[model samples]
Target: MRLCGGHSGLLLLLLLLLTSEFPPGWSELFGWRDKKVLNVECETTGYEIVGDDFLVLCPGHCVGQQPLVWGSGVYASISSVCGAAIHSGVLSDSNGGMVRVSKKAGMRGYVSKFANGLRSISLPKWSRSFVFPEASRSMAESSQQWEQESIVSTGDKVDGRRLSFEAYRKGFLSSEAKPAAKDVSSPKGPNPFQQYIGRNLGTASRKPMTTTVSPKKMNKDCNVDIAFLIEGSWSLGVRRFESQKRFVTKVVEELQKTTDGAAVGLIQFGHETKTEISLNKFPTLQGVTLAMRKVSPIGGTSNAGRAIDEVAESFFQKSAGNRREAPNAAVLLLDGWPNDDLEVPARVARETGINIFIVMVEGATSEELASGVHGDFVNKSVCRPNGHFSLHTDRWTASSALVSPLVSRICNTERLICSKTCLNSADIVFVVDGSSSVGLENFPALLEFVANVTGHFEIARAGTHIGIVQYTYEQRTEVELGRHTTPEGVREAVRRVHYWSGGTSTGAAITYTRREMFAHSRSGKRRLLVLITDGRSYDDVREPAAAARKEGIILYAVGIAWAIKDELDAVANDPKSEHVFFVSDFNDLKTVGPKLVENICKEYNALPRN
Candidate 1:
């Protein structure tokens, strides 16, 4: 009918002849066989979730809305199905019979009677299908080549002519749009100042997990990403590597335990540089773990720098808002010195703005390296790097797993989880009894107590500052004022604190805190002193109470079993009663930790009482 209005049989026959050269269902026939895409076709409308059969969707006769169906975890909507997400349901609408409702991606389903039961199944962002076989083949071949050579993946317009498909009961043909040919010159990716490296610690569960939906990105300025570059060198030995591998595995498993939206990547560098088993290779958690298995610590050169380079290039592409991000900070786990050129890595660190951290296993020192080795390379990265994967996950276990060093950093400021530290910038110090009554057996518990409480803060926006001072007959400060602005330092200091055995000098410590801490305190600052002691002080506490009250220094006393209630009351800010706590014993110190910190933070809940 083009240019000529009269319908001609010869013209129609010619058009059909041309179209026949490109079969409509050709792609459907070869898609799965050729590994073009996970070819999925539903003889019944709705999704046939992976690992699920008979998951069908058809309209319900209900007067309210369309009916739903559940096969696996996915649900579907099959009312007047145009294009909307589906849900689950029981036997809904009377089908045009039990004939069967069928479906294929990109194409709608047919309800024997109704002509319009067509809808597009929502595919995961990471999951995709081809519109054409030849075009798909071309694109996939290009993508696969890029992948094989460790090249940055790319996409383009695929030719539909070569990918024509005729969707059927089992499969469909798709004409892939021709992809615009591009000359992709593989550039040497920026070296990582901060790298994310981890070995396949253990088998992570690939079972479908409920993924948390990310909030809509407001704009570019506020974006953050991070990755871990793990060292899988032979030097790690089987024993060390095995443990480290386990650590990395758990780190990944637990990452989703907290927040699924926290962008993360994993890189393993040893004798050879490979990241196929890493976060960089796949966008989905399942892809990541699948790749993780193919990985072995083969060809052993401790190329920590090479791993860093790959992470920097592969994951931390353009920065926060460019596309997907690399880690905002990178942690490098190495059993030994870097064998790659340090200057190349240093230059990359400078360019990528990645915060780099170097965690040397077996206590390898910076001095052990050749002359140019600089901790400053990773330390000075703009991304603020902290490296190490503690295979010692059992040191502290809760609902999730994480490397202690990395956990400490993540619990701090920048990305998310800043409420704990950013909401209030109060100055609070932990005063430990450290008397003979507190033995070394119970010391770790105290440190754990502080960690439990203080770790709640993310330490953002000059938010919260926590200090530690332990005293007996004599008082000594564990974490000095202004030592760590971030939560990592505070956690580290608390973990490394030295406990002393001596007489309780509660009064002397109180007096010292009031004079040295409060008297010299900055105006508008909320000074809080939390004292952990077993009982009354040797010296009179009345004087210190008056000074603290006068100075508005909120004093909270946590008594462990033998605590003196009357003396504790006097040390309180007001009726002295409100600030005082009576804990059952040191063993149960964790019970009272959150309460004490909450009380202090409550005051700053408004405008951050400083």
Candidate 2:
């Protein structure tokens, strides 16, 4: 036992090493070796802290694989460094500690460290990298002076990334910590990421995209009966409301100068709708502009559906200033989505010959805009499909910039041609009951309904062929199958149909339609017979209706006041709800016009496209 002081000290150290279990730094050494076994082939990778999170680009591996231990093995072991401080209370006491997910980087990992905490990550000398206009070397130099921290992981896939705490706080990821004008050049102004964000996400891109209408095509003389349906809710503050009014005035002033002169009307809508100017009220551009200036915003909830109904019922009438031959249009200025169901009313407006141009400002969704326009209208005609004739702006001030495109689309009559292309392929015949109950006064309403429905289809010899037959005690052929080649011609023939006031003969009309109206030559097309009667049939309808169905004719029945519902149910195709319509009176026909047209279009659209 007798030994020198240095030997004794060495002996004591050896005993301490042998006796201690789970010693400090030893566990870390073993953990580091274990991690190295699990880690990938230590290839140099790049990472960038986008917002509050870090996007680590793993080359050969995909998401869900183990994260690379980003450091040289020489510095504080991986466990004591990044993994240990996390489990211990040391890093948790930091003031700026808050967990956030990457908003734009589109990764699943959360930021695992803060400020000085990043020092322990042991970023290799070669690990610095970035994306976009900056060169890798320059980015590394700029980032080296600044301490950066964050982490990324992989999880269940979704709309790429969600819950961007940093993007929400700082607006968007900065192109450079300090962007020099000479360093970055992109088609989307200074930031190329602006276009990237808009294309992927439905948010404001770094630089707003502005679209303009071709001026050469804009100045041509054209006649349009246009009504401006504006949002006047409090959310669209007074300044924004005034901006909307100015946009409308500018459009009207330009349109009125054309040789044919467009008739402009105004409707300021919120919880309540006010007719600021009727279409017939102001014939000149000066009168319309002055009227628009005096119109004030009435604060209330956004109810666009009601405004559309008002425009369809009251705004686009002859008494209100609508010309029979002029193309009718309604410019809807929306700041937000409607508070009610917009589909049905929008359908009615379009079926009534009004071309809806939806101008969506900030706060409107792509879904709402798509539902507000006619489903069959082409993209170019409405400026864009899904959100047709729609111009989306980042802020209220940007709405002024949309006037040219809106005017060009609304004024240029050529685009309005597609509004008539509703049905793709069909042989449609109108079987009308010209009974005495549908007197001279109501006969015009009947013809108007027929004209409205006829206008919705593509009336070409090869597209959707149209014919009409008026029935009383006897059936009279008003329009022959494939007789008219254009929608205009078909509508004219419908208008010319004379009222033959007599007794109801629904069965005879159905039999005549099946035997004569649906010719063998037109058998290739979908046969559709729309029967309109106002009273009980004087003759039996069951046998003829069965015969019509047997011949492959799809029957749709519309009955006005005093007409039998049982007869309508019997005459219509198998599903009565899908094929039959009933109105209280002649004036109520417009109510069901859009629904009938919608069903017809739905049937046609569902057909297999060749």
Candidate 3:
């Protein structure tokens, strides 16, 4: 029964190929008989949105937010790769305006580029979940390569279509992306992924099934936990390199001695994908030091989304004891710009309650860094008493020395400056009427009005809170003021909002406050509700208004354009009392908001109950 040498060799080769190439369903799932059907259509005209399939592109999307989207199978396979199902769709309530899903909030996924009609997504097995811009962004090339490595041909069935993966590289061009051939233009540049691509041949194509976890949460104290997602795109260089390493080392050393719950890790990055470190879950100084020591500055664009997935996995996985206790902080030392985006990371940080303090040691201000950050979080420097104006990172200095101090100043020894400040039971919420009469045309002008209005109070006081409740026919919570009292939270709450349609429901919201909301206030602290409307309430705002005011609530109302100034005047506790305001336009509301806040400050219960 002894087999020949060549036969034995052949058998071993087959076994190796079967195990390495296909993990589970290698024999039955895929085969070389599979073929690829490439249907690609390019058009100069942008597609119009008819309904669910064809959605009209919003003007705002092109200007700001996740304006980058293309029809591709990229995101579809992401959930499979991570071994978790992630839903991807825009917000339902969103209109022709910007639509961003809370699910894909942080940066994660492969580096496949997609535009109006051009997109390449390759969710390959090598694409493990991790954090940092470099690892995820590199996926563009890796995915392209994986696409090339795949050999698939489908029987094209409506329900059960079998796909195969023989091998991907198809000389220069075969099928899949008709133009997916790696641009072999240069050996050096930003597109490092291209360099590794070589051609082979075509076969069949199969959609993927996977999940992407955040590097942060995965890298928890289980082993090497703390990680710094350093940006390594071509946009970056030696500029922040030196500072990145120094701060990283400093943080690592500090983390070592402390019996902190997590281990410190490091991951250098660039482009939109790549995780220098996955949620390795390594515990102890050896693992932490090893991870920190392995960071090698290299290629890719800044995609913060992956970092979020990393943290999401790493943060929430901690034991219940740790979860029950007050949390500790995880610091990220980022230098350079995030050329691409993965906002989900920021959301993960918030949802998982991770105290993610980003220290960007670069010349860019907070605004510039914000353009690159995961959740578009603002700087904590600009805070006001009534919670109107918060600072943007653009407002902060970039020098390491200056930036570190600012980071320290913003993040109190316990938690976020904004979150803690409001914890003192003093975040304020203001409901405004931005109907036709009190509206601003452009977003900038509107933001300015909001800024000026929030600017009056001395925010430095025991953390005065600020939140916005905008009403048309309906009401929208622009800023959830109580989440955090720091200037940063204030800005994020207001960043992506606008004054839109709807009638005034002054009374309903007032009732909601009395019944559902304000009652959930953290402690026995004074709450203020300021109302500014240009006209009379569409509903019976009187009874609720009277009820609230009678319950020792600080209720104030203002009248503007065609509004029943007399009725509003009565809504205020006192007509000429500093509690009342009147405005002609949206900008004017800002003026009145500050004045009211200044008046409230004068009623200082904050200083010395002594």
| Best by the lDDT measure | 2
TM-score for candidate 1, please give it.
0.34
| Whole-structure CA lDDT of model 2 | 0.56
2 against 3, candidate with superior lDDT: 2
- TM-scores for candidates 1 onward, in order: 0.34, 0.34, 0.31
Model 2 lDDT per residue over 189-235, tens place: 11111110000011111121111334553446556668898989866
Which consecutive 10 residues in model 3 have the weakest lDDT in total?
Answer: 195-204
Tens digits of lDDT, candidate 1, 1-610: 2435565434543432344321233324433221122111121112211111111122233212221111112222221121121212112232211111223232222111111221122211111111111112233333332222211111111111222222221122233423322312212443232221111011122222233434352111212345667767766666666555565566554444443333456677776676544333455444454555555666576777676666544454322121211125556665656666544553454333345555545533555456355645444432323232122222222213335445555534333221122123467778888888878887777788878777654342234567788888888888775567666677788888987989888888988877765554444356788888886688888887777768778788888877788888877766454578887677788777655654554444333210
Candidate scoring better on TM-score of 2 and 3: 2
- State the lDDT of candidate 3 residue by residue for 1-610, as single tens digits: 2447668545533443343232233323333122221211111011110011111112211211112121122332112111110112221112222111111221233443322211222222221121111112222233343333332322231111222223323232333322222312223322211101000001112111111333443332211124456655655566456556655555444434333333333555554334554333343444554665556556665554454444434332322112211232344445534444433344334322344556544345476556634333323211212222221233123333443343333323222322231123344556667666554663344555555445433232233556677777766767665654445556655666777756677777677665555665544455777776677777887788788778667777766666787667656665346667766655555555445544554343233320
List the candidates ranked by lDDT, beginning with the highest: 2, 1, 3
lDDT of 2 at 287: 74
Q: Ten-residue segment with the worst summed lDDT in candidate 2?
A: 192-201
